[model samples]
Target: MNTQTYMQKLELLAERSISSYSYIHSLLEELKPLLPFAGACCTNIDPYRLLSTGAVVAHNMESIHHQLLTYAYGQEGVHSYDNMTPSHTSVMTLHCATEGQPEQSSRYQDILQPAGFGDELRAALLYKGSCWGYLTLFRKQDQSLFSEQECQWMVEIAPIIAKHLRQFSLAIPFVNEVKLRSPEILMLSQQLELLSSNSDTHHWLDVLRQHEGITTSALPRSILTVASMALTDDTIFDQRLHTDCCSSSLPCSPIQVCVPVREHDYIDITAYALYSHTSSIQLMIAIQSASPLDILPWMMEDYHLSEREKQIVDQVIEGLSTRKIADILHLSPCAVEEHLQSIFAKTKTTSRRELIARLLSQTDCIISR
Candidate 1:
């Protein structure tokens, strides 16, 4: 099929309300005809920190993820996903970036070459300035290098991919309703290896690995990103800190992040560096369900709600009646009802039950602008 036809298929697929994993999996299958690759890795990026929240790997790309993350956080490599500007055409190839001498890239020399991979095409899936994820396509040494024309085509559809990823971030899965369990614990070595984990870790790990395209043996990119953050020197990581959590005045202990596994259920991951008298020891990670406090911030930003509206939405999620919400906020019942009306309008729901269901359940087929 031609590029236009393939893109049409992608557009149609993007319109469907599906899980992020399903969307990404189908997207890769469709891209095969337009831009073939030996292997690929689609990673969900935390827009705030530009960190990998999860990843979907096809073919043998999973083999190199550990090394890739090491290089990604270790050095400023050529065409780093974080460095790429968020645009419809935010894409680059190692050969093009290195002016045909791909050897100039440390990632190419250290990671790609050894993996038997050649040219790499990477696109940062950014929607309206927020990077939702990334797509990295790899060709084998024997295969032809990705042409500039192909890179341009990827640029054209990059925004569409970003839009779907962002939309799917809020999509509710069709899976059985499994409320997030209590906090689980895990221990990791400085090298980012899983040293030990409690029994509860399996439940969370299974959910993460099942949805995140990770094998049982491999660490999910979310865990890897947080664990890496804990081990990284503050001096080096300070340059990359995008949030205010690392301000000099405040004591930042364990680095914590709320990873959205589905629409409303978020896995709160906190990584702590265990240090001894002389040096740092193993890294400890606590995993659990994110409270409404944590989930509301993302929902408010995505829905573009005001602070008061967010407060109401929080109470609505708790099944609070308008009168109860008003009592808590010291507002009259009429005022609370008015605020609820606005909240429903902004969230595209009609009644309180519908609004609550919208917040708790999967998203509709509404595509983001």
Candidate 2:
């Protein structure tokens, strides 16, 4: 792609949300110039819930491979997944499998060859230092491996793509079809829908709106700003304090957050920071409120943390010191430390501060905005 077109497409990936089918298609179409390929697949990861969502835009394909590749980051022995590390965007060729000789590998013989694709380029959608989503582009059997220039370009744009996806995930619930209480509300609601609608989520939302006349509209600008603050809260605060110690004037973009709006207990909003080259805009997506008081127990189910470990992390988020947490839980300081260590291992945090920030950011959206 020409420099102008390349930058323009990358901008599109940043502006668009990923909840709709067309959104996924547009993402692939935009990237075609960089690595002209036969097809593409996207994986959206929700680290909070340990969930991964897959969307594919391929013709005459089976579902198993798509399902497998969607969660490839978490799965074992997936070179394509491992290649797209935070430091680099990688082009993985099936003809040159990392597992062994290409002809001996099952993935190459069964999947890549059958699909007539030889090369796979993965650009992991990362946010907050986690692989939240993945975009994989494929080439025809006779196609050459992706060039290093393409890899550099892909890595450079990965952050922007991830930022948009985070917004898309946050915006999904906000654009739900709400009952139009007035003409003004109706007009803005439709605009919100057009601006940030997800295909499957919007379909289900439309059904609910038809079933029950519940009035919904875009969040006010004031609340959107608050939700954005509440959503990011301490996470961004810490990032700036630690990462931007020297570059004090360079402000970070306001990333999206999911949170509950005030007074209206039934409404939940996903606040997004729409970043541009020159400036950024705060957007709010509203949905029904159903946030739990404590998410530790629920997260334990996903992370498989023992009850004792969950209790320790719970106390950590409550701002209790390790000794205080130990006394409260009737455990020795050493025992508390052990559980904290385990919690850190399972949740992938290095320190108490990081742990609390991670968990709180995940649930703060529901607590208040």
Candidate 3:
């Protein structure tokens, strides 16, 4: 085929293969005319399990097929292939993962003598830092040996196959092992969202504190942070109106406050803050029901903000001037101002007052245990 035609055919084949279960078998059948192969099979390699997915055996060899052949080769001990005897039984497919390369193994002696086969090749499929599975192709006695070109083709296409297989596996829903939000947390999140939409800073804070108390009573490890943006522009700076407060004796995790509304070319600014404090200025608040150290990972995952932003946000909320924030964070005041500009842009608040009010208002609803 011409290069363009070949490329088009490859794309069409890939789309078909991805769409149906029988496509792989059909693929092998098509390739048989091009390469010297009797049959082929695909298997998925879990940590302790090998599952055969698609298989095509040569006529009348169904009883001793390639699927069973490969499985027997992998199993603990059958002693049928003497030359390829079990040198390693539990070779976890780590080589494929580390190098992003496929490993090929073949034994002429074993194939010719005990196995009564001509030649075989095993190609490992690696994708996304894991070994997805392997593909095995066989040839009969009269057939020609697999060429270097064929091996290279198999290696090149292994990643594509692995990706497709991974996607297909993920598409299969696991009804038996699904997680859902608890009724209480769902209700509490919704109630907090509602309260945050309407309340003032002071009232929101009180409600948030009560909610924090309840949450601590239930999930002793949970922390709450509330902020108010009641006077802040929700479009520019989506801030919280109230956040839960906790005592130093019963410290909560440091809540990283994030405002997503962009302003002045910034997306959002985030900072870690204490939930309970003695200040009345209340620009932004961070609450913790868990230890500060324990909260960092959660903050990273939950807010998806960087450490630098978190530091800046924390300093800003603590009533620190831009210079102070820069000094503490070891950044130039100009740099701090740049980050703040981005923060203001993202939060949609032009000034600190508006930012704080918005944050405080949003965190108004909280459920204490």
Candidates in order, TM-scores: namely: 0.74, 0.48, 0.35
Candidate 1 all-Cα RMSD: 7.4
Please give the lDDT score at residue 119 for candidate 3. Answer: 57
Best by lDDT: 1
Candidate 3 lDDT by residue in tens digits, 21-107:
344455566566655566565543331122222233443444444224433433212222221212222122212222322122323
Error of 3 at 149 (Å): 2.2
Off by over 4 Å in 1: 1-3, 15-18, 86-89, 173-182, 233-253, 277-280, 304-369
- Candidate 1 lDDT over 1-369, as tens digits, reads 666776778778877735777778888887876688999988887665677778888887767877787777656457777567543347988888888998888988888999999899999887766788989999999999999889888877887788778777655443235555666888888787788886668767877777586667677778888787766646434533443433332223677777777533666888877654333357888887766556555666577666788788888878888889999999999988888888888888899888766655543322232
- Stretch of 10 with least lDDT, candidate 3: 260-269
* lDDT (Cα, 0-100) at 354 in candidate 3: 70
List the candidate 3 regions with Cα displacement exceeding 4 Å: 1-11, 17-20, 47-61, 66-116, 173-369
What overall lDDT, based on C-alpha atoms, would model 1 receive against the true structure? 0.74
lDDT value for candidate 2? 0.50
- Residue-level lDDT of model 2, residues 17-109, one tens digit each, is 334334566667766765687767665554342223234435334343433442342223545555555454433444344543555545656
Clashes of each: 1, 5, 61
